[model samples]
Target chain A: MNLTILGCYAATPRTFTNPTSQVLEIRNRLFLIDCGEGTQVQLRKNKIKFSAINHIFISHLHGDHFYGLIGLISTFNLLNRNNDLTVYGPKGIQEIIKLQLKLSNSWPQYDLHFVELTSTESEIIFEDDKVIVKTIPLKHRVYTNGFLFQEKIKERKLNVNAVQNYEIETCYFQNIKSGKDITLEDGRVIPNSELTFDPEAPKSYAFCSDTMYNEEIIPIIKNVDVLYHETTFLESEVELAKKTMHSTAKEAARIALQANCKQLILGHYSTRYESIKLFKEEAQTIFENAVLGDDGKVFEL
Target chain B: MNLTILGCYAATPRTFTNPTSQVLEIRNRLFLIDCGEGTQVQLRKNKIKFSAINHIFISHLHGDHFYGLIGLISTFNLLNRNNDLTVYGPKGIQEIIKLQLKLSNSWPQYDLHFVELTSTESEIIFEDDKVIVKTIPLKHRVYTNGFLFQEKIKERKLNVNAVQNYEIETCYFQNIKSGKDITLEDGRVIPNSELTFDPEAPKSYAFCSDTMYNEEIIPIIKNVDVLYHETTFLESEVELAKKTMHSTAKEAARIALQANCKQLILGHYSTRYESIKLFKEEAQTIFENAVLGDDGKVFEL
Candidate 1:
């Protein structure tokens, strides 16, 4: 799994900082999340192909989260994209995008689908043979949701030498990989564990941003390989963070520590802060594996 | 009059080139025109204060023309801007912006006014004591208008030496500046021309963009001091220009020549070109004063 941060600032897009947008590549599929203003330009700067984005997940209706949706959709139409595109966002997202397209008279030729999300509970939004995507309800000033991407457990790997030594037929190889015992022609049964090895553990990632310090999300994102949480402020500004329905760095770290996430990525920093390293320092006080999420930062897990 | 080209490319914004957006400073008031995506960042890069802009003129509803508007407005609210903002655009612009704001639940604290335009004829849209802004109707894929910013004729300058020599009272200075002859206490009428010199000729600038080669705007923009015209394509791609309802470089030059504009600024070049200098070469073949308009390029007229 690979994750690319296209933007990781708060409020508005600045000359050197962007609002909030990221690309998560899992099982060779790219999923976009929280397309803030200037996302397309950020994509260009990062050399990410526009055609690779098939699914976009928005956290909320805030401009800092989804203002770039209409422009990105319009660019897709201008490029003559024909593949189907799906957007998973807040309830009013479809209306906002469709209204702009209608006014511009530049509807997409491709199939554009919207899954308007209003659910306040964790529920699967996308599922396939290799991966599953579920929503993590978040507390914010508006209706918002974070997404959890989990890779499905893979089939057991065949131990070729062990299988050949056991005289397992080709037909029985499939059963052995499926964790089933193999039956020989001599009416002897061979244990599946003797012919196959356990597959690598699956990885999971949870993205939560633009939310307050709410512990209710811990249950939904527990034991994730990686957790990206918003650190819009430092502990010094904890009061402001709470008043504005945002989380401070220490608060995000506390949530990560309680949730048992392997690694914590801090992002959506308020532009008022002089340096983002301060957030990492503050988060590290609670979680040892806390790291700063800067624009264009890439992580391979 | 000062004109700053925040973005001048056509179609979609790229890694280096931007879409259509500019700032026109007339009589010390900044007027934003055609805010494409990434405009706020561009404004920041150019050091143009967001608070200085009180009026925005959108030529059309095309995404390349006005997609950045909603984000800019939202940023204004975030910045706590308290000044009034007026937008003049096509009839549906108000609905489009208001709908986004409503969905985001981020209504502006300042008074937001919209002047929806539906007229196909040229008419005055903004007027003040020092300047007059009139729409120059243009033919495009959508309802479009080019803006003509004419600096209203200034009052005659006071000849300080001549006035003092005549011992003109301060109370009569206003009348003298208004081109009224001064009458001495002895009933001797002083000629207005002798007391004051003519002010510098009022300058004018017309912004024409996203329009095809049409002569209908000649009367409206005739004899303008400077004209910024869209040159989306070179003469070699005239066919595509017609199909897209965009003007070619030579075509823009032809319009400038026919309109008798003193200087022609060519902008909105298609990103397909390897060099923007070709546009200037082609435009200058038809009009001597034609110049290329680049992102961040400023013009003082």
Candidate 2:
């Protein structure tokens, strides 16, 4: 799995720094997260294929989070997109998008679907054969949800030596990979474990942003391979962070530490700070495996 | 009068080329015209003060024309703007803006006003002491209008040497500047023309974009000092331009020539072209004072 940071700044987009937006590549599928105002341009700059994105997840209805949705949808229509596109966001997102499309008279030719989320409980919102996505209810000034993506268990791999020793038939290979025991031609039973090796461990990633320092999400994102949390402020601006329903770097690190995440990625920095190194330093003081999420930075998980 | 090209391409914003947007400065007042996506960031990059823009004119409801408006307004609120802002656009623009603001829950602290226009005829939309703005109705796929920014006739110059010879009192200077004949204490009446010289001729600029090659706007924009016209196609794509309701460089030049404009600025170029010089070359074939409108390029009219 890999993640590309298109934009990671907060509140408003600047000339050098963009607002919140990123692209996650999991199991050969690309998912867009939190499209800010200049996200489409950032996507172009990052060289990510626009058609590769089939799903977009918006954390909230704030301008910095979802203002680019309409423009993106319009551009998709202009590009003659034929595949279906799905957007998962707050309840009012559908109205905002539909209204703009109607007024602009540029409705998409492809099927555009909106899955409005209002549940405060963690629930599965997307599920496919290889992966599943669940909502991590977050505390913010508005109704918000962070997404958790987890890969499903893969099929068992064949142990070539063990299969040859057991003299397994080619026709029985499918059953053996499905964890089924094989019956030999001489009426002897062979355990599946003897012929096959265990599957690779599944990986998981959770994205949380534009939220306050709330520990309620720990259970939903516990022990994930990678946890990306918003750190809109430093410890010095803790009071401002609280008032704005944003988290400081130290607070995000504390959550990452308590949740037992393997690695923590810090982002959504306020433009007031001249350097993003401060966020990584503060986060690392609490969690050793913390890294700063700068624009155009890619991480292999 | 000064005009700044913030963005001048057509259809969609790209990595290097932006969509339609510009800033017109007349008599010390700034007017934002056609705010496409990333316009706020473009404004910052161009060093234009956001607070100086009190009025915004949106030509149509297309995404490329006004997608950045909501984000700009939200940014204004974030910056704690206290001055009033007025937007003039098509009839449905108010609904589109108000719905987004309501969903985002970020109403501005400043007074936000919208002037909805539904008239098909050319009419004055804004008038102040120094300048007047009129809607130059154009032919487009949607309801669209071009803006004409014209400086009002200035007061006659005092002709400092003539005033001193006449021994004009300071109290009557204002009247003299207002083009009134002055009466001395000895009951001698001096003609206003003898005391003052004629004021500099007023300058005018017309912005026509996202429209076809229609001659209906000639009367409205005739003899303007500067005319910025959309040139979305070259001569080879004339049929496509006709079908898309856009203008070619040759056609834009034809209109400028017929209208007798002092100078023609060509913009709204399609990204398919490798060079913008072709537009100026084609336009200059018919209009000698034709120029290309490039992003970040300023023009003194």
Where's the lowest-lDDT run of ten residues in candidate 2 chain B? Answer: B99-108
How large an RMSD does model 1 have?
1.1
- Which tens-of-lDDT digit does each residue in B1-301 have in candidate 2? 8999999998788888888899999999999999999999999999999999999999999999999999999999999999999999999899988987887777889999999999999999999999999999999989999999999999989988988898887889999999999888899999999988899999999999989999999999999989999999998999999999999999999999999999999999998888999999998888999999998899988
> Each model's TM-score?
0.98, 0.98
The iRMS of the candidates, in order, is 0.8, 0.8
Looking only at chain A, give the TM-score of model 2 against the true structure. Answer: 0.98
Q: What's the true lDDT of residue B235 in model 1?
A: 94
- Residue A230, candidate 2: C-alpha displacement in angstroms: 0.3
Error of 2 at A197 (Å): 1.1
Q: Candidate 2, which CAPRI tier? A: high
Q: Candidate 1 chain A: worst 10 consecutive residues by lDDT? A: A166-175
User: Model 1: what TM-score?
Assistant: 0.98
* C-alpha lDDT of residue B167 in model 2: 85
CA shift of A234, model 1, Å: 0.9
